[model samples]
Target: MLVVSLIAFVMFRFIGDPVDQMVGLETTLEERAKLREQLGLNEPLPIQFWHFVSKAAQGNLGISYQFKQPVAKLIGERLPATLELSFVSALIALLAGIPMGVYTALRRESILSKLFLTISLIGISLPTFLIGILLIFIFAVILQWLPSFGRGQVVDLGWWSTGFLTVSGLKALILPSITLGLFQMTLIMRLVRSEMLEVLRTDYIKFARARGLKNRVVNFGHALKNTLVPVITITGLQLGSIIAFAIITETVFQWPGMGLLFLQAVQDVDIPIMSAYLLMIAFLFVAINLIVDMLYVVVDPRIRIGGGEA
Candidate 1:
């Protein structure tokens, strides 16, 4: 988080003067100087960074230069949208990818399996923005089946708001979720198929088959179980990537998520927002990785045994 914060600070600090964005052209030199002093932009880089770090540690992310609101407040307002989109995308990827992978692995010679592979290849090859645009063209423009952009309708519940309870909100999520998830789904599918094939060739799988185990039991209970260790790792990392990289999809869809907020900050040179976003994303990556590490023990007994021995 410190490294990310420093990088964000250095990178954004020099992009433009925050005072220039904060103040109008008619502002005098004395006013600009006072504003700089108030914002601490006149301080040395090290001192500024120290103040940033210290305040961040105390749960104060500072106020946004552009929005003139608290950084934490801005993020808190937008976080739910991003998390909702990311989790829905991740769920779509895992739900579709894993079954497709298993089927392709088990029915490699079938024409249907070949078709799925072809579709997976297309999913992997398409860029996210292009995919989103295509979906919009098909579903929104041509078919008039779904809305092209916006969150549609959001229901506020105290401090948090959500779209899931509303029908239009659920409809609004479909395109962006699919666009964001397609690449990840293809990746997970390919990984699972490859791992399943490898696992099937192992001695344990052959032993289970030789023991007259049913095909479903041997394939799913044994082969699929063993393939999941790598799958879990990739899925966990991809979930983090979904959140971090949702910027493109959010921009394309105008989804009002943190990514969209970050883009606005970049354009406006809102250093506080940019810095807070960097630190938040870094913290999320760390937290997701820690959870993934814990999940390894739950998914794979070998990891637990190795840890016990060491």
Candidate 2:
């Protein structure tokens, strides 16, 4: 994560000046120099990086030229929306993908299984932006079933509130969540099928079958339990990618989340905000992977003892 932050720091500082985006081209030379010094852009790269890391360690992520607020404050304001989208989307994927994967794995040679595999392949092939557009064309343009864009009306509920549960909000969420989660659903489906097949071939699974266990017990009780490790790993990693994809997804739908903020920040060369965003995401990925590693001990005790089987 430190290395990733370094890369983002070096890449962003060299791309363009935040001053250029904020100020007019006709500004006096002295004023431009003063502004550069004010933002610490006139410092050497190494010195700038040092200050950045030092300030960040102290919980100061610098200011955003776009919003004229601390980068942390802007991110905090937008984070709930992004979290809401990710939760809904991941819920849809896991609920739909797990069962679909189990059934298809159990009937790999059947026609229905083949059809599902083909559909999964197509879904994995399509990008989120294209999927968002198609959904909008169908639901927003043709059928008129849901809104095509925006985060809908803000629902106030005191400390922490989201508009997603309201009627209008639900309509607004449908397309973006589907758009964001389609790839994850297909990915989880494929991972589950592969893991289930491997588990069913193991000695324990075969022994359960030979012992006259019910088919459901042999499959779900033994095989599925064993198959969850990889599913959890991939799902954890895929959840990180969801944040990255949300940039494109939010841009397509105009949802007011971190992704949209990042997009706008990028366009306007908001270096402070961009650096904070990149660093935050890098930290999130590290934290999520650490959680996944810890979950392995709980899910499969054998893994805790250095054996692959539990």
Candidate 3:
């Protein structure tokens, strides 16, 4: 994470001063120099980066060049929306994927199974933005069933709300959640199908079948339970990816999340916010991976016994 943060910070040096972006062409070099000095741009790159790192340790991500507010504060305000979106999307993926996967895994050679798998393939193949646009066209523009953009009105949920929960808010959330979850849903379906197929062929599954256990018991009880360990591993990693990679979906839906903030920062050449976002994203990935690694021990004690955590 530190290495990635350092890289993110260093990349800005190559982009030149963001003050160049903010100042007018009529501005003199002397004026630019003064502005740079005011923004502490005259300092050595390493020194500036160290200062950023130091402030970041204290949850200060510096000031946004565009918003003119502290970057951390801005991110804090936007984060709950992103979290809500990611959480809802992952829930959709899991609920939709697992059952479909188990059902199809138990009947892989059927026509309906083939059709379902084909759709999952297409789901995995399409770009997320394209999916979002298609959804908007179908549900928002043509059908006029759901709103096309934004996070909608906030419902007061006391301590549990991001201020984005209401009848209108729930209505607006549908398309973006489906758009974000489709890829994960398809991926999870395939993983579950593959794992289930392999598990069904195992000796325990064969013995269960031979023992005259019901199909439901053998599939749901024995095979599904065994398949879950690997599926969980993928789900954990994919959930992390979903949170970090929601940037494109947020932009398509115009959702007021970190991704939208990053887009705005990019358009305005807001290097401080951009750099902070980059670092924050990398840190989340690292933190999620660590948590998932620890979960391996809890999920399957054999890993712990084998010293797999190192």
Tens digits of lDDT, candidate 2, 161-274: 586668888778889999999889999999999999999999999899999999989999999999999999999898887876788889999998999999889887887888
Screening candidate 2 with a backbone cut-off below 3 angstroms (N, C-alpha, C), the clashing residue pairs are none
* Model 2, residue 52: C-alpha shift (Å): 0.8
**Candidate 3: misplaced stretches above 4 Å?**
25-34, 156-164, 307-310
Candidate 3 residues 1-310, lDDT tens each?
A: 7787787677666676688777778999899889888877789988988876787888888788777899998887787888899989999999999988997999988988898899999999999999999999999999999999998886545433453547788888899989999999999999999999999999999999999999999999999988988988898889888987899999999998888999898888888888888888887777777887888778777888896565
* Candidate 1 structure lDDT: 0.92
For each of the candidates, the C-alpha root-mean-square deviation to the true structure, in angstroms, is 1.5, 2.4, 2.8
Please give each candidate's TM-score: 0.96, 0.92, 0.90
**How many clashes show up in model 2?**
0
Best by lDDT: 1
Better of 1 and 2 by lDDT: 1
The order by descending TM-score is 1, 2, 3
- Local accuracy by lDDT, each model: 0.92, 0.86, 0.87
Identify the superior model by lDDT, candidate 1 or candidate 3. 1
Q: Which stretches of candidate 1 lie over 4 Å from their true place?
A: 307-310
Clashing residue pairs in candidate 1, if any? none
In model 3, what is the error at residue 297, expressed in angstroms?
Answer: 2.0
